[model samples]
Target: MPDYSLLARQLKALLDTRDWLTNSAQTSAFLMQEIPDLNWAGFYLQRSSEQLTLGPFQGKPACNPIPFSKGVCGAAARTRQTQRIDDVHAVADHIACDSASESELVVPILDTNGALWGVLDLDSPRKARFSEADQAGIEALVEIFCQASDLD
Candidate 1:
């Protein structure tokens, strides 16, 4: 189990006095350091109505400008929901930017007006790496980031 409360606190504190772009990099680094079994941690910004451009991230290189009709990241952004995929291979139209990624989690960032701002994406090499509790916790952390930064 992870200390979600402490993680949220740290994220909030980190974003309390920094620009979103600066904090975006820090958020990725923070999650990469704090979370276990994570191969990638990052963000995608809404560059258009149905397009997501890659933002700050940690891990190997990834796909840029993922369409809304594409993979897990697209699905999350399109539906404005969290897509916690336990197995990347089983999903249809799954984009394998990193062959080492076996599982993925994507959380869409919705602003105060309930509009899509972007997404927080995490990838892991192990199957079934993310749990519902992990999803809830990360959602909270992303919420803090969205609230504190210029991401909205």
Candidate 2:
């Protein structure tokens, strides 16, 4: 299990006064380095109510401009909730941005005003790589991220 408290503290300290781009880049790198069993870690900003444009990510090239009606990221955005899938292949609507990714966790990002912003997406090569604790931890980190940057 990862130490989310430490990660949260470190994330806050690292991104104290950075811009969105810098923070996004660092956040992806941070997740990639800090989290284990992760094949992909990144953010997808909501370009529109129905579109999610790919942001900073550490992994193979990803599918850009995903709609809010498709994939895990879309499901999270559409529902404004976290979508943690144990097996990507098992989900009929799963979009294979990376075929090697067996599991995925997507957390919808809500700005300080509680408006839908984007999502923090993580994928693993192992099935069921995430637990409920991970979902809570990642949600906390995303909260920190939202607090640090002003996303509109």
Query: For model 2, which pairs clash?
Result: none
| Residue 71 alpha-carbon offset, candidate 2, angstroms | 0.6
Query: How many Å off is the CA of 29 in candidate 1?
Result: 0.4
**lDDT, candidate 1, 1-152, per-residue tens:** 68999999888887865478888899999999999999999999998979999999999998998999999999999999899999999999998999999999999998778889889999999999999999999999988887787655
Model 2: per-residue Cα lDDT over 34-103, one tens digit each = 9999999999998776999999999999999999989999999999989999999998889999989999
Please state the error at residue 109 of candidate 2 in Å.
0.4
> What lDDT does candidate 2 reach at residue 1?
91
lDDT of 1 at 132: 98
TM-score of each: 0.95, 0.96
Looking at model 1, which ten-residue stretch has the lowest summed lDDT?
Answer: 11-20
